[model samples]
Target: MTWVVLTGRQNHLDQAATPHKVITNRDYLAHPALFRGQRPKVINLSNSYAYQSRGYYASLLASSRGHRVIPTVETMIDLSERKLYEHALPELELALNKCRKDLGGSFPAKAHVFFGIGPSKAWDRFAKLLFDWFRAPALEVSILDSGEWASIRKIGFCPLGRMSEEDKKRFLDAMDVYTAREWRDSKARTPARYTFATLVDPHEELPPSEIASLRHWARIAEKMGVEVEPITKKDLARLANYDALFIRETTTISNHTYRFARRAQQEGMPVIDDPLSMIRCTNKVYLNELMTANKVPVPPTVMIAGPADFELAAETLGFPLVLKIPDSSFSRGVKKCSTFAELKTLASEWMEESDLLIAQKFIPTDYDWRIGVLGGQPLFAIHYLMAKKHWQIVHHKASGKPDQGGIKTFTLKETPPHVVETAVKAARCIGDGLYGVDLKETKDGIFVIEVNDNPNLDHGCEDTGEKDEVWVRLTQWFLDRLERQGR
Candidate 1:
């Protein structure tokens, strides 16, 4: 049976008053009687005096059809016609009085009424109130049309009304697939294959060697029976169909990684190197605080809030210090200051770029151990030896070059035991599923340089000369986790 729904006011022809034709047109267009013997049901859902004729018509129709007439009691008075704020005070008071009079009888738990004539500036104000009042879960109020109804069912409410039917349908389809995948039992049938995309620099495309390495890793996943799809940021949205994500590039909390991670979290997808982990790893100040709280050994460091604090930091931490931006990666914003003048000059430049800076005692070490920690265990450890002249391995000039002295791999067996232990402890302290810990072996002891949320797994670097044992172990580790998750 068809239903004629009249929202807001009704158009009356008997009176000389300007009629609300939109409501009448909607009711006429949705008429059910024209199709067959079935008569259309008319419901007058309005909260204004202008709907008096429509309410009367509904009562007449109900009496003729022998149906019960549902009349809504008027508890709210619309004051949009009143020009001044002072003029609306009395109508508001009258509404309050009506509410008090019918408090326990037939009045709803809450009365939400829209008080505007047209979709103008005044209507916008009333619309704001309508949204605020109708937002209550207990009160059932909405201004959704057919198109809006479908759109709301898909992505969510879009009050501005810009979504097309195609967009709505696509979103709905994705949501259906997402729900089905989530509810479906993996053990009952063959596991459904899912896709995932990772964010990578468009300019810094993965080299052929790196792509070969990824292919090798994919083969390893195939052997372990786990599916993986490595993609860049441009294609990340297409990965909405994926069950989980593994971001391989350096993604900061404030970058595209955060957006992708948030979306994945909302869609119930498992996102490794998630936003929380990225936040913890990207900020050097955060890591330092966490490490200190956990009693993890780290280099003595002082935070320089601005250039003015540099002298104080120098006095406190002493000279020959390391200056670094809190959220920089790949040794992008790190500098060594040997003298007080150099510290002041470097601090000024660093402060202009970033508000938070870390000044620490230089380890005076030539190499640092990069230990890959997966699921709270040290999967592999490699020494990142400094270039012959540069303090850090990532040389900016050679960054454009095909091959640079970025990382020199070494086995965990060759790394100092203390470094390995420190890396493992640091990773455990972070408590994330996947992370990388950079630790320096100083004369005193092993100190954590930093922990990275997204660490590089360059091709042939994880090779420990144990007959591809590391790759096999990593593949097995990932698969085991996925299997345990029942995916």
Candidate 2:
């Protein structure tokens, strides 16, 4: 069987003389096989018609599978003046020759022939020729309505259509997976280790126990597969090479640790035991405000803005209250007022020494809950017991003997559940990854008494038989996170 291709315009034939095979838009959509593998040839039958019918012919043939051909009709006018005659002629000829050779003989009379033809202007002949040279091939052509040529050119099919939607989506998904894997590998290739420069007061050398603890931490770091270097104040410049820092001694923002931490933060290193944390932790008033705002239960407290605020505070809070300076820690600069007269007298003394003080209702709690939080998670909890006959955990007796008021410790299991919950909640509210929370279980509920940014890890304290395991776990967690993030 022979196949024929058509282009340009469709012509009416005598149905009695030749059996006709019609390939219409409805026929193609219903039965695509009717047009597939067929060739089409187009002939211009109308004069003075614009090139509008090309779109219909293109759409029909593109939906089918075959070559397309268009016969050139030249006019005496200039090449630019003839439209369809100028454009599509060359490509149509090429398609016609191919289709004829492929079909093997005379054009198939019953074969599909699609054509889109319209009148052309003499001035547009050259431009039309250029477009015709690149016209896509189709199985059949048809004479479409006027103005259809422009629409066809706009929405016509290209030989270089993109892959199917499913294939494209699969390709993109694979690319994403590959990119993620590469990123993970790159991060794993470079591990991040921190260098620590801790200040040791040369005048006040570190105690033997403290030094031992430092060594212990170093060993823990090593076992956890992390690199750590400990340097002194004289070697402070070495901090520039580290990821984070820790200050061993009590220091102020004006001191060396603050400068180091600030510089590290500027260098894009995540600094813990940060200066701002230190400042906030050092100030009792700031802690109280933060705890209260976060809805963490706290003892009823009043600020002694000045000596005058003391009388009103005393009347509201009543006697047997706690008074403390804004920035004092370690139970220092704190006093308990048992009576109104005593409160007034202490307020006056404190007003002379400090600009602000806090008076809180004393809950008469015997033990305080201490919790160490890292990365917004509670690592451990302990109960610090007060000494006999002393209301505070720390005592400043002139005798200098081991103050009976020294603190004793207990494990999380021994600590009350409400205490742990409150401490954890308070620590999370603070939002700092590392901090210590002191909570007191009151008659009403557990109240956060204070938060310490840089909590102490004193040696020889009650181990609760899990110190080694806890430290190892914490160190490993930090190291794993650092490694995953590539510092």
Candidate 3:
């Protein structure tokens, strides 16, 4: 992916400050080369986005030419009228109220945001959410204090000339982070046809894939004429520069991973763990309903909304049942209750965070079968053993680190035919994307525990039996889609 920054005043931008190409707004609008060449991310920083203004037309023309532009024409129009942006007030106000204590007891009348970077760490989250909602190079926001809370009164574009020296420094620094200033020069390497963005979080305690495994995939992709670049949460604005997005972090609908997936989908870029899959697979309650409706084998489950429903759950599932939050992952939000008292206590604590909970009949197993399905077919199989003296495969400690049990990989032919067939059928309940179907093999039958959208594919664990072929097939799935899209 390439970047092109446009500005009304060329003097405001120093070309040497960053490696990305910076040109006058007129050049972007008048230059024939930009109109006919490869699509690049256009950063429109014109003085004003008024109707028929230079910035307005710049974004309009970029969209018409199939290039991604910031502060899109719709965004400009939304900011032009208060009624257009009223729907966003409640969300902004809620975020502000959540972080009011961190504001040092001072609520300013207004603030400036540069490339989603605010003045202090206290406003960092609010600024990021603001940028996620409205993508622009610079913004001037009016803060309204109503005694109880502060809300956004207005949102408008801030021109380059209106910025102070300090604002200019912050803007440039934020741009550096957005573009990945430390990224290696692609000019020195072989040019690829497709640019793949692998979204990851280095600090994640339990990442979906290890850093070494991600690097391995990158090496393989490079050989196949694809460029795989590692991106983080801060790189949401850079989604336009990629042909496809591969999420390598833990995905949750409430976090930046979902935002990244959604942004990629909006950009018409192929993405694994697509937004729909995330929405469906992240919620166990939804999965229970989906599997039951589709006739997929699953354990007896009950939805607990309050004490009234507890009796029904206790009667149907019996004692020693497992309780799960709607969006439990990695065995964190799941618990086992041996008696009714424990159930009540855990339910009371867990219900505070969620409106409903999932209670299932306990099906003890030495190991759970993980069937990796990609593009609607079986990709790999593994037996995820339970942690020592723990019922779950992962043992999360209070210190934030986690301990995991060993894994045993099996080839597709070696895995039981019933397990493979049942896993495939379960995965089909979700969209035809990358999925991991967890099943418990018992005397009665094979039952699907849950379908995971973003499954763990580490260096030596899940990739053991399939080895390099696993990566080859995964990369091919993305390439096939890109070719169909004619990109």
Candidate 4:
């Protein structure tokens, strides 16, 4: 959660976290554990991506310890230069064309580009400003090439070369012109001491235990010397006021919860249901891919791409299989097709929205293990019994809220080691934030059904044995992050 800028030159304003010499400019590359131990969050804007560059190692070393890094190593090495030409060039071109339309056909031969080489948290906006500033063809925008001539341009740029005093002044002045006062690296400061926002929907019809969990969180956070307040979607602008945002409302890729998570992330606020966690946990198809890649046990599954694949899936997965729309949650948008006819009908319906449908072998079980994982550890475990006469915890067939079943809680010590370990491993593949890994204890073996980001953390349910310690453990993570981040 701490912020610092990594550059090949002398540090200027990135001060939230103490600046250290980049490997390229450093006398030596310190041990990776130095960063692994400190675990400070970093913004990688170092000019070099060559193998041993500080930018590359800073990202590699810090992220390996679960430290947060913006312009992640994946974005830095894989997506920045080489991938930019492939993925971003098209959009850049379109932005230029739009600019040209506004400029009456004469696209400027030169334009300022912010290379995400600073400590500004408004990198997304800066990327936008470049496109917005130049509506003309972007291909014509000439960056500084080999020629050396008298030039002074005020704009957001990564200074990798020795700049004359006048040029340096222009660059510094442009930093002020482009970056907002609060966003400027010079204005960066330690995060709020302890102001935390729990994103919730007051209007939502939450269960009593769910409501109790929130109250318990607030009470626990207060005792920890942290101020916790409930903020709704309407309080988006105020998200900046918090050191962390814990989302209690259900997370959907298309909903306000996603926006809150994203906003919190962009502002460098420690947040649960991190946009990556939410995105990875919400969809079944993606989960299948992730689980398979990691060799985690899963129900025999196949992604339905077309009519031909449907039959292949039915043949392989067999009849009475479970069909799920990628984004379905809480047992909704899931169907059991007993025959090919039913499978065809259900697949048609699901495929209308999702390009692909996931079909899995239906392994009957009395209950499923809902392992609550936080910060890459198992916090709590529960047995989610199926609704009467149904195959899942929430039975969609039986009217409002669907028929439900009893909940049984267990401490991590009480649960099977394999279940807890497998669940944690599965969730870690998605990124360590918070997750409820659903696993089926079957005759063959325990198999991960899916991982839920916004898993149920209701009072008296998930908090069965640990009680307030559940909230304590969860909140302590944020506190630690705030500490590590210099909050």
Report the candidate with higher lDDT, 2 versus 4: 4
Which tens-of-lDDT digit does each residue in 211-330 have in candidate 2? 556656656665544444455554442343344455666545757666666765664455556677877777888889988898889889898988688787878788789998887756
lDDT of 3 at 470: 89
Cα distance off (Å), candidate 3, residue 263: 4.9
Show where candidate 4 strays beyond 4 Å.
1-193, 206-209
Error of 4 at 96 (Å): 26
Model 3, position 430, has a per-residue lDDT of 97
Candidate 1 TM-score over all chains jointly: 0.58
Sorted on lDDT, best first, the list reads 3, 4, 1, 2
User: In model 1, which regions exceed 4 Å deviation?
Assistant: 1-202, 205-209, 398-403, 406-408, 465-469, 472-481
Encode model 1's per-residue lDDT on 1-487: one tens digit a residue: 1233344334321122112122442353345243233223233343322334543454444435422222221211122222322443343333333333223322222222222111223223333333222221011222222321111111012210232454334333422321222122234322223333444444554321255565566555544444455656544333443546666666867766787777767655567677788788888998999999998999999988876787788888887889989988777788889899998887887788788889998877677778888777777777777766777766555456422354566666776677777888888877656778988886788899999887777567755423366567656554565457554
lDDT-best of 1 and 3: 3
Overall lDDT per candidate, in order of appearance: 0.55, 0.52, 0.86, 0.67
By lDDT, is 3 or 4 better? 3
Clashing residue pairs found in predicted model 4: 2-485, 96-136, 99-135, 99-136, 100-135, 100-136
lDDT of 3 by residue, 381-403 (tens): 99999998888899887887788
lDDT of 4 by residue, 1-487 (tens): 2334455655533333233323332411465554433334444555555566665676676556555554455544433344333544455444445443344444333543433111223223334534332211011134222232212122222433444454445444533332222211233243323667888776675422265567667666666766566676755644654578899888898998998899889878899989998888888888999999999999999889877888998889987999989897788888889999999988887777888998999999899999988888889999999989888888765446567788988887899999999999998898878888999987799899999988888878888967788989988999888788764
